[model samples]
Target: MKLAGLTIAYWCVLVMALVPMGCAWLAKAGQLGKPRRQGGFDNHNPRAWLARQTDWRARANAAQDNTFEALPFFIGAVVIAHQLGAVQMRVDVLAFLFVVLRLLYVMMYVADLATARSAVWALALLVNIAILFV
Candidate 1:
């Protein structure tokens, strides 16, 4: 049942799992090297550091949190779809679309495009739902 030796849908899941970390990296970008006392990223208390961010940094962190929230549903949908004997190509394509929409959602969030981001988030949610029944 493996597509190219490692189902494309599963590979999409792995890539989706990494998206939140990428958002975290975006939140921490360019402040990783400065001294903590000078407003640099604080590894000792990362959540504190992240909480103190503003503007796009804050949005990126928010995106990270949102992405994490979405991950479970996406994973569960993909797993359930496979277990239900869904068509492999259809599942794979839907999963891939979900990932693309999610990545776009992150970018729109960071760019302060509230409307577009919300729209993309809704679309991704629909895509995830489709994966469940594919």
Candidate 2:
């Protein structure tokens, strides 16, 4: 049987959502970059830079919370779309948009760009709402 578009979209979302955690794991393992020492003269260590860019613990917590925040909307959209007999393409598109926006949101969050992140988040919310109505 052919897979539903929404199903595929959710799969993509699942994969994308794992990326940050993977990065975090690599960072923690010293695979990505080494941790920075304060007042150090060398500023070229990529791992150290990545580690110092943000609080990994806080980012992990925020990532988990972000996943929690979006999960319900993702589920609701899929269920409503399926129940309404909405076109598969449309449902998939909306779901894809949600995932993309959320991914962007995470990047923005990591970079500490609050305003841009919130805007992207709002767009994702709009997509979720549109899916519910569709």
Best by TM-score: 1
Candidate 1, superposed: residue stretches over 4 Å from native:
1-4
lDDT against the true structure, per candidate, is: 0.95, 0.66
lDDT of 2 by residue, 1-134 (tens): 12654366566557655755654553344433433454232346544444454465446446546766677767767777878888777877887777778878777776668899889988988988987877
Pairs with backbone N, CA or C atoms under 3 Å apart (clashes), candidate 2:
33-47, 34-47
What lDDT tens digits, residue by residue, belong to model 1 across residues 1-134?
47578788999999999999999999999999989999999999999999989999999999999999999999999999999989999998999999999999999999999999999999999999999988
In terms of lDDT, the poorest run of 10 residues in model 2 is: 32-41
